[model samples]
Target: MNASPSHQPHPAEWTETQSLLPCVERDLPAGRHQFHKEQLMARIHEDLRTTTRPEPPKRRPNPFLRRTVLLPAAALALAGAVAGGFALSSGDPHGGRTALATGPALTTTVGAADAEGAPRLLDRISLAAADTSTPTPRKGQYIYIESKVASTYTSSVGDKTSVVSEELHPRQVWNSLDGKDGWLIEPGQTGDEGITLASEVVMSGAYDVLATLPTDPDALLRRIYRESDATRDHEVPRDQAAFTAIGDLLTESYPPADVSAALYKAAAKIPGVVAVDDAVDATGRHGVAIAREDGTGERTEWIFDKKTLRFLGERVVVVKAVAGSPFKVGTVVFTSAITQRAVVDANKQVPGGAS
Candidate 1:
């Protein structure tokens, strides 16, 4: 239930300062710093563009740096996939289904697995989760995560109409084990510099917070219910809030075996969770899913390996029609495949990549 920091506008003159300043100001050795402010700013701009903009305006390339300068550390945490669709399209009233290139959204007409489906599948998943071992990251280590992510937003080009755009890319994050620091490392680029994990970082992505979560199903569920209530202010349905909380936890955090098992079991207690026997991730891996439909005309599905019971990824599909949304029933608005995760020694280090 951690809230991301809201976006705040920065000084308009920051862009002018950036464009006017030299990458290397003083007489400095070439490799002493091994990083440039402009490069880091550019990388931050790109990240902001993908996460926050549908189609960023073309005024200045560095304008996004200003917007992103405002996103908090937990803002790097991916949005909860369970609340609604991934929003592959901007708010384009006339936009077509081009964003559905990965696949069309699955219509709600497709029946979810029966009421008994969740308990049975959850029992198996919980068992597997309990049996599996995920190392508890130590301080000074990095929790490295690699995933294929896609996001969408809408932009109004004029007073008359708007255009929707979607961006899909591979993202990697190296979070400090202590929840004190982190880095967002785009491929082939030095990790963006100076990321500080906020004290209120989301439970799912914060190692220290994950260690503190309750491992008992009933207790865990109650805790999530209460916390989500406080954060969402009862505006979101209890079940939806709980489900979204679980979704964020499942996708981003690797809790201890008992806590992980408890999360799945707790999800089963939520009223609307249903089973989907057939689901596919962005990586084209097929698996089963436990899903819930929100009032917002979308179904969030957490896919898991059918045989091993390992979580594969999550996806969002449109189930109802909405005005000003370029999505239709059965259109897969967003999909992400978690390709890998590991603990590393430094923020700049990834498995089999440069240190």
Candidate 2:
């Protein structure tokens, strides 16, 4: 009965049957038949009038991205702070002190006792000791005297030995005894031969000779002392000729004020001078007034022996130059030979001579 029905199937059934056949064949070749099956399925779908489904909207990343980035940044900042704190807390290898917030205060004190009384006493003692120790000729007095100078001199002519002897009269203005009024014998005119020449010389040639009558030796001595004191204070050139004349008569005298001051200044500049004592040259004793200069020559100090107040001596230490060279070339020692004897009578004026 089914075979009889199949011989005369309906048109609809036939079409369905044909569709089923093609689908079976497509199933056998899925890679090649997918497009055709899809076309047919699209046609069926179009015929069915199905509603279209809307697509979901695209989404963006979370808004917390800024916070995410800042988290790591914050971590890095904390790490840097920790490291910096460690560095500051650690002690420095070098010996550097911590900075101070404020500076220290300064203070000073003054008194009349220091400025007037004590200083004066000390000065008096110093002066007295100096006067007694050195043979300084009385000031302002004229004297006839002789000196034996021991010196080695080299001249263009050659080396020679010289003996200098003369009669010296100190004048307020005259510094040397070699001039016309000064008493120095010319070469070959010394001894008895110079007696006639000495007589012929005029007293007018004398320099700084005072014309005061009834010679006041004290006044003359005072004038000399005052001049010498002024010279010492003001730093005037030590008139060598004047000093020599005075020294010849008195034995020793202070260098001019200027020279003494210069020596002080120089001593101060020396690197190692710790103290300076006054110069001294009198009574056959010779030494500087000030004993300064440290042994090492790097620092200096001013020194005065409280008891003696006289400069005894200085100890100098060696110092090397920047280039490691020797700094000092030589050492100089200054000595003096002065006496405390009056060589001439204060009231005795030279015959036919102006005071």
**Top model by lDDT, which number?**
1
Q: Report the lDDT tens digits of candidate 1 across residue range 245-346.
A: 666655544566777788889999999888987876655667888888776666777778788777766666666777855556665545556666677788
**What overall lDDT, based on C-alpha atoms, would model 1 receive against the true structure?**
0.50
- RMSD to the hidden true structure, all candidates: 14.6, 58.5
lDDT of 1 at 158: 62
lDDT tens digits by residue: candidate 2, 86-160: 001111233122211211111111111122232343343334432442122254543332111110111121443
The per-model lDDT (C-alpha) reads: 0.50, 0.20
Error of 2 at 311 (Å): 11
Off by over 4 Å in 1: 1-111, 152-167, 186-204
How far residue 303's Cα lies from its native spot in candidate 1, in Å, is 0.5
